[model samples]
Target: MEKISNFLEQSRMKDYILKTKLGESSLSTVWKAEHRTTGEAVALKQIPVAKLTRHLKNCLECEITFLSSVNHPNIIRLLNFFECEGCIILVMEFCAGGNLASYIRRRGRVQECMAKRFMQQLGAGLKVLKQNHVIHRDLKPENILLSCSECNPILKIADFGLSRILLPDESAETVCGSPLYMAPEILQFQRYDEKVDMWSVGAILFELLNGYPPFHGRTSVQLLQNIKESTSLPFSHLVLPELHPECMDLCSRLLSINPDDRLSFEDFYQHNFLRT
Candidate 1:
C-alpha cells in the first residue's frame, strides 16, 4: 500500500526509462522500463487516455479493478498506475521469460510432464477467475506469460482487455476473443457464459501438448464451419501413444462443441490429468 502511495505522489512519464519494446496492440504498448531512483525493472503499459472510447475505458476499468483485487501467483501483478501526459501508465512486475506463444513456437511440442505442469498452473489461475465470476473472453498462448528465462518459467495470465464479470447463472452476448482460441458458440454469435473460457483453456492445453491449436480457419466463418464439422481434436499421432488416458479425456471434455457438454470449472480443476 505504501509503495502504491509513493507512486501516486512521485509518478512521471520521465521517471522511468523505457528499454525494450516488449509487446504491442492497437490499444496499448508494453515496454521494459527501469525506474530512475531504484533502478527497479517493470513492464510499463501505456494507453492513450485521449483516444479511448467509452467501451474501451470501461474495459480498462474492468481490468484494473480485477487485477488490483487479486493476489495470485498465476496471475500477473499490477504494481501501480497513474495518469501522465495523455496516457494512463500502468506499472506491472516484469516477466523476463516472455509469453507462452513465443515459448510454444520455439519448443514446438513440450514433454507430457511439462505440459501437465503448465496446465496445472493455468487451472490455478482459472480458479481465481471462476471464484470472482469473471469471464476472460480472451485466453490464448499470447496472453499467458512466463516468469523467467533461465530456469523453468512460472505461467502468469495477462491481457484482460476482453474480460467481463458474468455470474455463473447469467450469460453474455459479446463476440470477442481470438478466433482460434474462441469457443464455437462465440463464433456462431450465440450467447455464451463461463464455458467459453473452458473452450479457450482446452485450446491452449491442446497447443501446449501438440505445438498447434486444436482448430483453425482462414476466417471466422471457415473456423466455425470447421468446428461444426470436426469430430475429434487433432492430436499428434506420435504424441498420442505416450499420453495418459486422463489427459486425453480432459482435453476432449474441455473442447466439447456443445456448451452443455463442456467441462465446468470445478470438473476441470479437479480433473485427474492434473493430479500428477
Candidate 2:
C-alpha cells in the first residue's frame, strides 16, 4: 500500500529503528524501538488504521487524548505519537520490570508491606484520574507495570484502551472490564461512576493477599450472581486470619455493593491500613 511505503520513507528520515516485538493485541502491536540519533529506548504501540473500526478508532483516540493530558509518577507516560502508513504509533516510556500480574505469579502472594506500598501508589494515580474526571474502566494487575527490576519497584498504571473521560453529570452505562473485577453496578447494567474503580482496587488487594480473586465462579452467569449477592469479607474462609483487621475493613468498604457507601479517596488515604 502507498501508505505503508510512505511510512517506511518517513521512518528512514526520522531514524527510528524497531528493535523487537514487545507484545500484541487484536487492535495493535507493540515493539521496542530506539531513536537512532538520541539512542532512547521507547515502547511503540502501533495500531493499524486500516483494520480499525470506528469504535476501535475512538478507543485509540481516547487513550492518546487522556494520557497526553495527565502526568503522574504512578501513571505510565506517553512521550510522543504519530500516524503513518495507515497506522498510528504511540511512543511510551519503557518499563523493564514487566506487569504486576506476572510479578504476582512469580511471588505467589505479595507481603502486606509491599502490597500497601503498591496500593498507595495506585491510589495516588487513581486520585489523579478522579480529579481529571477520567475513569479507567479496566484496572487489573496486568495493566499495572513496574518501573524497573528493583527491591521495591515503583508501579505505574498502563493500558488506557478501555478508559473514558466522564462529563460532570454523566455515569457510564456500558459493561466493560474483567468479570472477576467488575463492580455490582457494572454487572447489573446500572449507570456507574468512578466507584467502579474502587471495587477493582479491592479485588486487586484481595488477590495480592490471598493469591487469588475474592470471587470465583464456574460460569459467567454464576459470577455475576455471586458478585450481586456476596457483600461480606470471608476472611476465615479464605484462611487469611493473620491479615490486619483494618485491611479487611478497608477492603469491605471498597467492595461495597452500594456505590454511595464505598470509601472515598480522601477516606482511603487516611485509612488505618495505609497509615500503619
Best by lDDT: 1
Summarize candidate 1's per-residue lDDT along 108-190 as a digit string, tens digits: 98888998999999999999988888889899999999999755899999988888888758998978889999999999999
How many steric clashes between backbone atoms does each model show?
0, 0
Give the Cα error of residue 158 in candidate 1, in Å: 0.5
- Candidate 2 lDDT over 1-276, as tens digits, reads 977878775775376788999788777888888889999888888888888777667666788988999888899999988777667888899888888888889887887778889889998888888787888888999889899888889999998888888866688887778888888888888999888888999989988887778887886678877877775765445447667788888888988888999987678878889888
Best-matching candidate per TM-score: 1
Q: How close is candidate 2 to the true structure, as a TM-score?
A: 0.89
List the lowest-lDDT window of 10 residues for candidate 2.
Answer: 231-240
Residue 155, candidate 1: Cα error in Å is 0.5
For model 1, what is the alpha-carbon lDDT of residue 77? Answer: 96
Candidates' C-alpha lDDT: 0.90, 0.83
Q: Which stretches of candidate 1 lie over 4 Å from their true place?
A: 1-11
